[model samples]
Target: MPRLNAGDATRREAAGHGPDFLEALARGLAVLQAFGPERRQMTLAEAARAVDLPRATVRRALHTLVTLGHLESDGRLFRLTPRVLRLAAGYLGANGLSSILQPRCEQLSAQFGAPCSAAVLDGPEIVFIAYGQPARLLNLTTMVGLRLPAFCTALGRVLLAGLPEAEMEALLQRHPPHAVTAQTELDPLRIRRRIARARSEGFALVDQEAEQGFRSLAVPLRRHDGRVVAALNIGMHSERGTAAALREAVLPTLRAQAADLACQFL
Candidate 1:
């Protein structure tokens, strides 16, 4: 089979995209995603390398993004401008999840005296969309738009548990579980079993998996139609307590809030 270029309309169409699949738009978005908090400023060569696109292709995409005010270039280096934040703002503003969940997450954070977050699965990773914070200084960095591997995070596990078995297996294959810390689970079969258990039990708990000192507990946030659309989680230091203790602390309140929000989706 030939490799399908994500930016090639003919390639995408031949691979199953219809006329409605705008390859140029997809390519442009791909280019935008190449720039993150770390890759703030990048030259054309760096951008090409980051997105695995040809220099010419990246050039066109960069030019298009700059023309649309999503990016700005200073001579040789290109970087995302403040306009990019507007894109995230639009999603948070338009989605009812932010308004409804932010308050609830804030309440949870206050109750637990830690950071609370809501995230949704994005292929092999989970992207935090909403967050709440308490007065305590914490090391968890799951701010909005942050992405972490699905196989290693409590948020990701709960969200993945909501997926169908075939979809979950495919994503796990793509991501391939890794042991981030000594406690991280690396076996794919065991990971699958854990996700299955989370689906049955309606929550997931991971300790020192993605971060060295972090412990996380997550539950699914379902839509009114009973589809799990997101994961809500609380983060604390590993010094806090065991997973069972954390589960006992917040499980009831988390489950209650999730259930209440499920009926209030817009």
Candidate 2:
């Protein structure tokens, strides 16, 4: 069984129902989300344990997903199928944000010789919606749906800076920061100060907090009306440059691209 984090546990407990809520649909989606990089495949019992549900209940959901072509099973372990991607495809196609950001990120990656990405804050995490990498290999690897804690990532810090102070404090209280590395700041007061700095400086630079030997710089993507909706970031190995050098080098380009993209949104 996969270990459930505090965020996952909280979400499960808050899966409340109203007149229009569909419990079956919710359970089916939960089952699909239970599969991750580690828990790629699971037996009926394993799936039930992962979601903290009954074996019989998860069995129905699993088979239902399999029948709908979203999952496949060898009569023992069940795993997601490519058809599940259609769900993400629908949103990407409709929003057109990914389509617009991909080329810009590609250009930025080529220019800086590092990876460039864009992400949006989701609850206590930041979800990468677009990413670009150079031809050469790097230590860090990220995808469109990758989720990282909002407290320790440069991209996340930028997004968090956009939130109202009260809401941000509440969110931090709900999902306290955990150390991703020795350098990660676990103190809530310090975390809040970093976010406040990002708000004042209009950008964030994090060093070896999310992953060892990696550093990232990010700026929020704001709409024409000046409402922040997402964040854009460039990441490179710490050995490549100092944080000051990285910010001085890429901040202009990052802010320029972000401004151009902001024009596209309402």
Candidate 3:
């Protein structure tokens, strides 16, 4: 994926509600978010380039974060401190969705001997909030807070199918789909159709599109009022079955779990 740039930041700032927007705070959070698995540490110049902000601006943000104990620097290279995880902890603690879904996901994983997960849509990606996997399955790397492309994963497609047409179109335009594997569908029209099918069918199934050897089936987790708040999915190796067979086997169980969860939502 391309690094977030100054243009993206500028557009976000512009999109923000006028006077109440704190540009400094936004910049600081942006700088913190720029750090990820691929970028664990960076010098001031490297940090600036990653966020595409000026060195001075990024320097101030870095120093502020360091002062707050969220980041640590060893004279030259800066990296996130363990304190940064408190932010994620606060969210996970406040949000009851993960707590409610985790046990059910674990049950599903145990029943099917595969990985089960729950995620919510965020911009062009779906952020995993809860996950469960069989002990023997070591090939899949899913975990809480993992982000995957929204256009490619079964969970993402289910969530995307819940979006309003205009919002979905805008999101598609902003972040055009890219191929993650040879089986990934890159055509926007086809992707939209797949999402539509998910909406109509109340489930989505993908065969080795997001990953080479795994297939997933997903269903939307909706509120009591019918608003989709997240998605639930179970993933297994491609060798387990064909996509149609997988759906026939697991879709009912996935939908039942989703419905059970929905009743708990407001």
Candidate 4:
């Protein structure tokens, strides 16, 4: 396939935006994301295919990125440099809430000897920003930057519970449930009822919705201004407790920690 020039790749990314839009910059960043653990290095052809861009365009962009030290190449392969972490660091440093919530998440993990995470709603997914994992050796892949479906997570439920009635209803209407497990709720009426229950109870507990054997309890993390800016959750395997037993045990700790974090946000 023919490769695109850097300018063309940028133009393509900003296809729908106005002429003043920084489409080229957006496309360049998207190209960086094309490399990951599974794809640590790629040739021009692979990079273009991965980001769905023209080969020539990706070639020029890669040349610019390589010169800028964001990407490094040894003739045959191109890989991202540690410089990428600086970009991520800048964002984390600016988000004061995530840092504020970290200690609370640590406290929750300490209390339960389990894993806990604090996240915010981003589109239809919950994106973890701060988390504590006591079993550091465990194979849990959920960490900062991991995004999971909101409808199937307790944190997601807590965030949804805080949404205004109209927006919440619209969200429900948009995503009529599909089952993640036999226990996952699919009916909008039932989902709405669940959200209402969460609002009334001041927390949410979900069992095996995103993945089998995983159970979680969550509460809204409210800011000083009384707006729910994020959610905090404690997670463990279902085998840790029976459905009823988990509710009685973990739910209280989750809510208390959420409240503790909320105070700081205020």
Root-mean-square deviation (CA) per prediction? 3.6, 5.6, 4.8, 5.0
Candidate 4 residue pairs that clash: 3-55, 3-56, 4-56, 4-57, 10-24, 224-266
lDDT by candidate, in order shown: 0.87, 0.89, 0.91, 0.82
Highest-lDDT candidate = 3
User: What is the model-wide C-alpha lDDT for candidate 1?
Assistant: 0.87
Q: What value does the lDDT take at residue 253 in candidate 1?
A: 84
User: Which digits, one per residue and each the tens of the lDDT, describe model 3 over residues 169-265?
Assistant: 8999999989899999999899999999999999999989999999999999999999999999999899988888899899999988888888897
Estimate the TM-score for candidate 2: 0.91
TM-score of each: 0.91, 0.91, 0.93, 0.79
**Which of the two, 1 or 2, has more lDDT?**
2
Clashes of each: 0, 0, 0, 6
True lDDT of residue 227, candidate 2: 87
What is candidate 4's local distance difference test score? 0.82
Expressed as tens digits, the lDDT of each residue in 1-266 for candidate 1 is 35446576567666797757766688899999988878988999999999898899899999999999999998799988889989888998988778788888878898899889999888998998888888665456648898888888989988999988898888788777777788888988888888888899999988888989888899999988989988899988878887788889988888988988888875
Q: What is the lDDT of residue 3 in candidate 3?
A: 45
